[model samples]
Target: MTGDFRYRLERGGVKYACPACRQQRRFVRYVDTLTGEQVADEVGRCDREDSCGYHLRPSEYFRQTGTKPPTAAARRKEPMPEPEPSSIDAETAGRSLTGYGHNNFALWLCSVFGEEIAFRLVDAYHVGTSRHWPGASIFWQQDVTGKIRGGKIMLYDAVTGRRVKEPFNHVTWVHKALKIELYHLRQCLFGEHLLAADPVKPVAVVESEKTAIVAAGFMPEYIWTATAGKGNLKVVKLGLLRGREVTLFPDLGAFEKWKAAVDQMPGVRVSDVLERRASEEDRVAGLDLADFILREQAINV
Candidate 1:
């Protein structure tokens, strides 16, 4: 038997009924590469890893079920262990905590929430201003353990609070800018580090760092965090938030995709506020929760 089985957990966070507990959206099914289908109904992992340890890999499934997977080409080589991602020094993070006076994003935040509240939120998030672009802000992604994962540098319009996308979408990473060689980026949520401050606080997750900051202003009840970008959603990284009460707010056109992500994450819920309230124009513009919130608060932007 050629060991060319390219079995993998299916993408889009599609979960099924757990064979062990008969629970829905907790089981991750395995898929056969060649056939473009699931290996078996019972072959997969249950997201309830602690409470219900039900895991059946494809090879084990074939062996026990008395079935041979179709052979393909070469024997699969042993996979190499991945290197641990690099972290920025705390000193670097400290140095960035300056220049906020000239930061466009910081100015916009002040305009929305007034100077006192705006600066308080900025200090709490440890957000920094950057010299990378004129009036750029750096949203540093720190882990729950307080390690600096990475910094996202982006230029924003001082008045509108919108990212400056006209002049080629000014965005870059701090690590890349430093010319750090072979830097492997393993990102956590944008403001995940705040969880340690209040472990029991429910987290409100959005698609942009700016949204997280804005939402935190209005709703001090929930710990607002951002995934940095929609494509930045990774199951394993998000699974770190398993025990916490988390709510996801995806952009207008991205509801289904983020809903699928919420499925794999057992207790997490996806908010349908945007989907329920947005007009066709709002959908076409792909507005986020922060936009609706600002309007609700009557904060002219």
Candidate 2:
């Protein structure tokens, strides 16, 4: 096979299911440049960079399929540009700002720090109350463009400040619940909007949305944002953190994995604060930055 690449990434909004992860619309298929068709459904790259790193090139596909490659003489058309990421309507997101009074997470925040500071934290992060559960809250992931990408809905106990898992792990997405068909959910870091608000301040990133909120209440200097979970520490999500000082606080037992992932990017550092301080019992419980900060607050009081 001659060195001229026969196919290119099929750009536009038509994403197929990833062959590896099997997640619908996350795979960018490799198109046959000569025919303007896909090499195969499975021949593409998965969009879940952090969790599902799968890329099957056209050359590799042809080799595996035992198909003849397109000769260098075959004319190739340039692929169309990719579509912009989807965003929730401003009106819909605006409507969610209310009803935080019934939000379990918000209620817990108020109980710990009082209503004044609690409301401030809620406003800063665009936290919303969800009627999906009796006392659930939505952690809306807003980008620097002021777009609402999606919201992570989770239920918590107002008194314990811990997630409720009795009736099954209470978690869902706003996009899914709204019945938005073909909704392309591109997750930005939770509290990402704070980067634009406090540009000069160094950024402190953690895994949990609740941790980001509670840590912000205690450490106001750092612009706190969250990866939203352990598996969400993707390069694309952290792209906005470039040119700024960034520190990632991984959950217990996840320090090594997170450090390896972020090591490729310059100007980014993963903190060992939890790793250094946690006891074996704390590690077993999988505690995070919020646990440490909250425990310290309780001890001081």
lDDT tens per residue, model 1, 144-206: 888888899999999989989985989999998898989988888888888888868888888
Over 4 Å off, model 1: 1-76, 235-239, 298-301
Clashes of 1: 0
Q: Give the runs in model 2 whose Cα sits over 4 Å from its true position.
A: 1-83, 235-239, 297-301
Q: In candidate 2, residue 31 scores what lDDT?
A: 82
Candidate 1, TM-score vs. the true structure? 0.72
lDDT of 1: 0.83
| 198: Cα error in model 1, Å | 1.2
**Candidate 2 residue-wise lDDT, 17-102, digit = tens:** 88888898899988877777787878888989999999988778778888866554554455655567678887888788888778
Give the Cα lDDT of each candidate. Answer: 0.83, 0.83
Q: After superposition, how far is residue 17 of candidate 2 from its true place, in Å?
A: 43
Q: What lDDT, from 0 to 1, does candidate 2 have?
A: 0.83
